[model samples]
Target: MKLHFKIEAEKATSDIDVTIDNLVVAGWAGRDHAAIEHHIEELAALGVPRPSAVPLFYRVSESLALQGQRIQVVGAETSGEVETFVFSAGGILYVSLASDHTDRKLETTGVALSKQICAKPIAATAWPFAEVADHWDSLIIRAYIVEGGSKVLYQEGPLSSLRTPQELISGYTDGAAKLPDGTGMICGTVGAIGGIRPSSNFTLELHDPILNRSIHHSYAIEVLPEVA
Candidate 1:
């Protein structure tokens, strides 16, 4: 089956189609000298081990819902903000925003399974990586959560906080073929503002001041009843 994603093309007035075959998420990708130790400590408190490498790749399904789509989750107490990198088969790389919508409760049990629980939501548009490569470190990622009626800043930080896209792609390849065409990777996210918590709605964006453009996407979370 084919997977489709929306994109605001450079020439098109409306969104266009961006197809892919695989989706991956890089984890424990913090670039700080203490990044590994920091994540280890963070997850250890919750009973998880720190990965051996700074950037570990988790391959997710390509089948994903687009922006504005309502995704259902069971026991998903929170959604982490993230930026998704899209690899076009023709060799064009683009950047978009996404929420690695996860089930926090299940996270305590299994990180991969917890990640597989919800339908990932991604932006309807994307920005060419070539245009932002020079100032890539300046790109910013910001996410907001709708609790009750107001939107609260859930996470916000610059791309510099995490390993560069090239570094991540290299690590993920690990002496293998370069990330093939039709591959989409969700770059790791920054720390949460007030700790992880549930939200009825989630919104995220990737801002590039150098190019004066941003990629944005939002979705509503409909928590399904848990049945054993």
Candidate 2:
């Protein structure tokens, strides 16, 4: 074994998304951590499940005072084990094959992958990134984990109906999920030869099952834990 100073370095990887019954909510400014924590306690007293699949949310957004100001709120209803999302508030609820959402990724100039991921960031000036969410699907994310974060993408596509609760979990049938290149895919297969069987692809078929619902997302993502 080769040893320098006995220090081991880990490669950057973006991988895996898991379902959580509870999620910490944050806003443009900051998350009301204390308020949300208290709410969690209240839900616990009310016998809310330890983990929830269909989330019911109550929240307010910009322009509360002005007349016609809107609020964003939504909930999920379950009957006979079938669950659906009900979004209302801010006038309507909608779902789609895709929607616009913002997030961060890492980019560098010297490397090939970085060059592609940060294509525009390289030019002196360029059209603002058009398809950003797709970046989460293809870009290497762990690069930012050690040093910093990068704001690089936005996603937009046909949005479903407004004024009605749209379904985000329904309609999908089956497909192979193409994860980003550096996705931290665990649980690879093994051959009878007992060698490393590697793959970054997942075969998914949607049914009325919890595993299917949990794996379906409007967007693709791979995330890492934070430093303490």
Candidate 3:
């Protein structure tokens, strides 16, 4: 998948296009072990199986990465969670906003399968990781869902709530310093506010308070009938 992005660096901004062949979704990646367990238990309550390892890495198709404002799902049993997206482009790592839209029903069967069942939406803008590496924890991530024509906050927390990008990249690469070029990963997200539920539209945002800027994207969900 070729993704075009505007790289917002400390000094200048440039447009770059990169091809991503490997896409991985990091799960159970909370910085606090207790919080990680809490999320695990929460999913378990929904019938999703427990993960075999902490910070589990699930490889998803690169084609699933989407920049559009709308996505189609098999049924109404799917929802989106906002997460920070990290990718390497031109030898430089960049940070962006993305939603790991997932099938709640299929999640009970297999987490990996559920991840592959829906389109992953991402923001077209990104900031160079180096620009925010010093205060990465200060970055905030948030998600909102439209329910009954009203936008409600679904999730909100600082990036510190989840594992850092360096830790995630190292864990995924077995102690490697950086992700291979053309690889993109969506770091785990914070728990939902009310609960995980489907919505007609989902919005994701990544705010960098230090830089006084944010990346935002919204997408509508089109639920298609599941004919068995």
Candidate 4:
């Protein structure tokens, strides 16, 4: 999958088209073990099974990466969680935002299958990893969902809550300092504010307090009727 993104750096802003050959979603990646277990319990309440291991990596199709304003799903039991997206291209790493939109109902059957069935929406803009390497933990990720015709905060937390990009890349690549070129990974997410639930629209944001800038993206969900 080819994605066009604007690279925002301290010295320059350039447009780069990245070709992603591999896409992986990292789950249960919280820095704190207790927090990770809390998230597992949160999902368990909804019938989702606990993962066999901590920080599990689920390989997904690169074609599922999307940069559109809308998406379609099979039912109303799907929801979105904001996550930090890291991409490697031309030997350079970039940080961005992505929503791990998932099917809750199908999630009970299989987490990987539920993820594969939904489109992963990502922001079209990215920041160079080197630019924010010093204060990576301060960066915040948040999401808002349209609830009862009003936009409400769904999830919010600092990147520190989850594992760092370097940590995740190393974990994924078996101690490699960086991911292979033409690869992307969606890091783990924070817990939902009011619990996970389906909504017609979902918005994601990655805020850099030190830089005073944010990358924002929103996508509307269209639920298609199920015929069985």
Models ranked on lDDT: 4, 3, 1, 2
lDDT of 3 by residue, 15-127 (tens): 99989899999999999988888788878878999899989999999999999999999988999989999999768899998999999899999999999988899999999
lDDT tens digits by residue: candidate 1, 1-228: 144445555555334465667878888877895655665676666665556566778777777534556888776575655665656545667667778877777777878777777777877677666677899889999988887799999888888888887888888787643567877788888877876677888888888887677887778888778889
For 53-152, candidate 4 gives per-residue lDDT tens digits of 9899999999999999999999789999999999988888999999999999999999999999999999999999998989999999999998778999
Model 4 accuracy (lDDT, Cα)? 0.94
Our tally of clashes for model 1 stands at 0
Top-scoring candidate (lDDT): 4
Cα lDDT for residue 5, model 4? Answer: 96
Q: Show where candidate 1 strays beyond 4 Å.
A: 1-16, 65-68, 176-178
Measured with C-alpha atoms, the lDDT of residue 25 in candidate 2 is 13
Candidate 2 residue 188 Cα shift, in angstroms, is 26
Better of 1 and 4 by lDDT: 4
lDDT of 3: 0.92
Preferred candidate (lDDT higher): 1 or 3: 3
Question: What's the CA error at residue 1 for candidate 1, in Å?
Answer: 6.3
The TM-score of predicted model 1 comes to 0.88
Candidate 4 TM-score to native: 0.99
